[model samples]
Target: MSDATLMLSGIEKSYNRGTPGEVSVLRGVDLSVQRGEVVALVAPSGAGKSTLLHIAGLLDVADTGRVEIAGQDLTDLSDTRRTATRRADVGFIYQFHHLLPEFSALENIVLPQLAHGVPRAQAQTRAQDLLDRVGIAARADHRPAALSGGEQQRVAFCRALANEPKLLLADEPTGNLDPETSDQVFAALMDLVRGTGLSALIATHNMELAARMDRQIRLEAGQLIPLGGAQRPA
Candidate 1:
């Protein structure tokens, strides 16, 4: 196994594998993100970028190949062990904030840490610190509906990082906002990732945003290929 914070070797995934309508998504994909590295995953609609992210984040299983997080290969773990590993080693953000409408921003962030066995007081402290990191601490008591779009997404970033996962998988985290708001929210995310020295694989269609990362990889024909210049077959 490699020493990457997240790594995938020969990863493959298919839907309805034995059926006539079977579709392959990721095919023999290989990638890795080291500590403090931020990589952009670029793909057009229906390119299976999210599917790859799900497998990397441990939210879905691959049909073959290996997935390693923080140097531990997870392809052979039982469901119970996978769940525990996911809870402890991965953080995910989506295009939507997906914040609990009924809970305050602080509560949304605190809940994940609490579920991960952090004491309530410590969880609350961590949540508050995260809020402050994203410049949303002043709005910590607000519900999702009460915050602006950028603020809401900032809160979502905090929630994703609450458990201090070594790898963060974000799917178009700023895609829902206007360009101005997207920039702000993306900056906040970058700050948090850099501050914590976490590795991130962020899937985005926005080229401008992708260029801001440490490196860029494009998903084409069911495989990850480097962006720009000569490319690999799917």
Candidate 2:
């Protein structure tokens, strides 16, 4: 078993396969995210970054390839096992804060843990700790509608980390915010991730944010290309 937290090999995905309009999005995409390392995925729209994330997070299957998490080969897991693995090992965030409207900020974070079979009392404690870590503890009882954009997104971040997953997959996490708020929220997110010592593969169009990650990679021509001094994963 390798030390990588997430590994993808020979990944290939295409929409409308076998049809004239068939569009290949990912072509032999390979990536490896080491334990506790944060890697930025830099790509423009339509570059298939989201598709890659979905595959890596087990939310979607690749047309062909292998997906591994924590050195375990998950590519062939049954749907039930995949779901179990995903819930246990992967955390995901997106451009928008998808908190449930009726749930308070703390409740939003507690819900996933409860679903994972954590006792309600223990789940609430963990959720409150997460919210506190993200600097949103004061807003725990507020619903999404009551919080500011930054506060709402912070709640979303806490919710993502609720399960203490080994790997985090974030797609444009701060993209929906204004410039200043984006910077602040991104900082909060980085702090949370680093403090937890979790590995993350975050997709972003902002070069500045990408530079803050441990390494950067870009998707081009349907393949991942290492950027700057980052070495390609063997």
Native-to-model Cα distance after best TM-score fit, residue 80 in candidate 1, in Å: 0.9
By summed lDDT, the worst window of 10 consecutive residues in model 1 runs over 225-234
Which residue pairs clash within candidate 1?
A: none
* lDDT per model vs. reference: 0.91, 0.93
TM-score of structure candidate 1 = 0.95
Model 2: how far residue 148 lies from native, Å = 0.6
Per-residue lDDT of candidate 2, residues 1-234 (tens digit): 589999999999999999999999999998999998899999989989999999999999999999999999999999999999999999999999999999999899999999999999999999999888888898899999999999999998888999999999999999999999999999999999989999999999999988888899999989999996343333
Distance from true position, residue 136, model 1, in Å?
1.2
Q: Give lDDT tens digits, candidate 1, residues 99-138.
A: 9999999999999988899999999999999999999889
What TM-score does each of the candidates earn? Answer: 0.95, 0.96
- Best-matching candidate per TM-score: 2
Candidate 1 residue runs with Cα over 4 Å from true position? 228-234
Clashes in candidate 1: how many?
0
Cα lDDT for residue 92, candidate 1 = 91
